[model samples]
Target: MRYRFESELRRWEARLRDDWYFVDLPPEASAEIHEWADALPRAGFGAVKVVARVGGTSWSTSIFPSASGVYSLVVGARVRRAEGVEPGEVITAEVELV
Candidate 1:
């Protein structure tokens, strides 16, 4: 399934002294992922493999389940730069389970 949503960019400080950014998948999409994942095998940490695109850039990655009952898609430096998105900015992302 393909899930599309817009979300604000957010950042978290990692123990490695680095900043990591991600966007939480909206509840609707998150719920679907949960249902689908429940019936299939997932990667470590309950991550679902997906093909995600933002702006004109796309990559293969995994969205992980968050404590808040949603999934979070990590945005890497390369994708952020290519998409010209920053923290607090709203970005439209499309993710397809693969």
Candidate 2:
């Protein structure tokens, strides 16, 4: 199944050591992912594998649960370059569970 949503690319600092880029899934999409996760064998960190498309770039990654009952998709360096997206820029994303 596929889900689509729009969100801003956010930059977060992890442990005050390095910066990380991510997009938080919208509430509706997060709920759907949670439901799907309940039926699948999860990997480390209870991550759900997914293929995500942003702008003109598509890549495989996993969504991780957040304290706020949402999921966040990590945006890698390659994807950022390919998509030409930067932090705080809103972009449409299409994610397919894998």
Candidate 3:
């Protein structure tokens, strides 16, 4: 299944003292992903694997659960540079459950 949405790229400090980037999934999308994940064979970290496309780039990643039933898609540095996306910029992302 595929879901598309626009979200602002955000950056936050990770526990290791480095910055991490992500795009938060919408609540509805999060619910759908949670439902799909529940049906999959469990994996470590409880993350839902997916293929994400942004701009002209596509990569494999996972959506991590956050507080209050929310999820966030991590944006790697490679993808950010390739897509010319900066934190706080709104970008359209297409996520396909794999």
Q: What tens-digit string does per-residue lDDT give for candidate 3 at 39-95?
A: 864456888878899999999888788876877888889999999999999999988
- Write one digit per residue (lDDT tens) for candidate 2, span 8-40: 998876645666888888888888778879886
**Alpha-carbon lDDT, every model:** 0.91, 0.84, 0.85
Q: Sort by TM-score, best first: what order?
A: 1, 2, 3
Query: Over all chains combined, what TM-score does candidate 2 have?
Result: 0.90
Strongest candidate by lDDT: 1
Q: Lowest-scoring 10 consecutive residues by lDDT in candidate 3?
A: 11-20
Off by over 4 Å in 2: none
Off by over 4 Å in 1: 13-16
Q: Which stretches of model 3 miss by more than 4 angstroms?
A: 14-16
Give lDDT tens digits, candidate 1, residues 18-84: 7789999999899988988976657899999999999999999999999889999999999999988
In model 2, which range of ten residues has the least summed lDDT? 11-20
How many clashing pairs does model 2 include?
0
Indicate the TM-score of model 1: 0.92
Root-mean-square deviation per candidate: 1.4, 1.3, 1.6
Provide TM-scores for the models: 0.92, 0.90, 0.89
